[model samples]
Target: MRLSQFFLPTLKENPAEAQIASHRLMLRAGMIRQQSAGIYTWLPLGLRVLRKVEAIVREEQNRAGVVELLMPTIQSADLWRESGRYDDYGKEMLRITDRHERELLYGPTNEEMLTDIVRTFVKSYKQLPLNLYHIQWKFRDEVRPRFGVMRGREFLMKDAYSFDLDEASARVSYNKQFLAYLRTYARLGLKAIPMKADTGPIGGDLSHEFIILAETGESQVFCDKDWLDLDVLDKAPKSAEELQSFVDWATGFYAATEEKHDPNAVPIPADRLHSARGIEVGHIFYFGEKYSKPMNATITLADGSTTPMHMGSYGVGVSRLLGAIIEASHDEAGIIWPEAVAPYHVGIITMKAGDAASDAKAQEIYAALTAKGIDVLYDDRDERAGVKFADLDLIGLPWQIIIGPRGLEKGVVEVKNRRTGQRDELSVTDALARVGA
Candidate 1:
């Protein structure tokens, strides 16, 4: 993509309303625009990053054997009534009514609806152990929605529902999602620790909130420091047994959110107990038959008896992750995106945009990199050299190739690593090789 053609309205000064670094950078970088108090409109650059994050979540969900199917942003309130949560869900649920005077709502979560669907079609134990997921928009009426997308009222979420015949099988399904979440976050270059959490309105006894440590986080968390070194993707071709082992390895450490902490319990060694603020990126709940029983989602067993199917729900705050990642990975300059979810892998800056020699050289490099299937953002704007350099750094592309008139005369270009701040003047061919063209 060419910067001259892109609609990036970057600002020189931070917005006064943005209290957090991620929120400020997001607005100043022209990644998003506030539509209302908590609603936002994602710009082209922001959408690219959002889709990249969604792709990782989808891939990990697929790897865990969860099928994807999108549910609606608006759902009938009848389903909630069936599950006996129509009034219990409180103000967080955005209740509504349609033209015909029928009740509806922008679903905050989909437990009741998913169970209703299962009971309508699935009737036998043979079809048990099915996991379905969807990446869709959700609306929760937060009284104080701040921090940009981190606590937005309307956001994208990846919610997966799992069904099983019994508790044992349901536990396996839960472990599958647990492992998937670990891989998903790791792929996005985040060290998310699974801390025991209060289920809140989700109403589940067993729940874990995957949190990424950041000083500007909303919640305080306590955990052992060693969780930083655990890698979920290291073990390939994951199975239930392998997932159980990973769970055991992770749970062996002491980790708890404020809601789950016990003052009377044996304390973790003071030095080992790392207390920090963190953002909740994902959450998993193993609420067996919680919704199924209430919604009458029953399946027939081998003995010809019918019983409620055990179920679990797993959620990843897809949009919030954009902010959480920035909180975890940004520096003073701007966001340093993980390669897997970076909007563009490289930023090609034509320092002398109108100059024939510099333009030609940058175009050549851009063509070569694009041909090699690399996503390169070509800055062909007629801006000052310093401005171009600063813009490229602010966007935080992994690499920057500066084709200045001086460098072009020497048949060399300045290659800069955004993360490391390392610069090297190399021949065009050497630069291409270094950039994997």
Candidate 2:
């Protein structure tokens, strides 16, 4: 993408309403624009990152044996009523009425709708361990939505519903999603610690919230320091016992959100206890028959007895992750995106846009990287060098290949690492190689 042709309306100054680093940076970088109090219109640059995050979530869910299927945003009020949560869900639920005067709602979550789907079609234990997921937009009308997408009223989410014949089977589904969440965050360059958390309106006996540590995080969290170095993804657990063992090893360390924290319950030494503010990126719940039984989502056992299928719901805040990632990764300059989730792998900045040498070198580097399947943002605009550099840093591509007349005269280009702020002068061949590295 060339800055000259791209529709990036980057701001020179931060938006006054943005209270957090992520929100401010996002606005300044022209990644998103607020449509309302809690609603946003993702611009071109922002949509690229959002799509990358959604893809990672989808890949991880599929890797965990979860099938993908999209459901509607608007749901029949009858489903929530059957689940006995229509009124209990409170004001956050955006209740609406259709032209026919039938009550409906923009689903805050999909437990009731998912249960309705399963109940209508699934009839036997043979489809027992089925897990289905979808990446879609969701709305929860926050009383005072703030902090950009972090606390947005409308956002994208990846919610997976698991159906099992019994409690033991349901746990396996939960463990699968638990590991998937860990892998998902790791791929996105985040170290998410699984913390015991209240199920809240989801209503379950067991729940875990995957949180990423950040100074600007919304809530306080406590966990073992060792969690920062754990490698559960090196080799995935395959059996039920292995999965359970993985869960045991992961949860053995003390970890809890503010609402569930208990200093006295922690067995770890004070030195090993790492307390920090964290942002919730994902959540999982094993609610047994919480939705299934109430909605009569039943399956017939081999013995011919009908029983409510045990169910669990897993959620990843797809759009919210942009804010979380920025919170966890940005510096004073701008967002330093992880390689996997960066809008572009390399940015080609021509210090002198019209200069023969600099423009030629920038085009050469950009073409080379582009042909190699690297996403390169070429700043071929007739802007001052400092303005170009500032915009490049603000957008925060993983690598920046700087071309200047002087550098081209020296037969070299400067390659800079956005995250480390390290710059190196290298030949065109070497700069391209370094970016691949």
Give each prediction's root-mean-square deviation over alpha carbons.
1.6, 1.2
TM-score to native of every candidate shown: 0.96, 0.98
lDDT of each: 0.88, 0.91
Where model 1 places Cα greater than 4 Å from the true spot, the runs are: 235-238, 258-269
- Which candidate wins on TM-score? 2
Candidate 1 TM-score, true structure as reference: 0.96
Error of 2 at 416 (Å): 0.3
The TM-score that candidate 2 achieves is: 0.98
| Candidate 2, 192-262: lDDT as tens digits | 89888789999989999898999989889988998887775775686767998888788887888777778
Q: Candidate 2 local accuracy as lDDT?
A: 0.91
lDDT of 1 at 58: 97
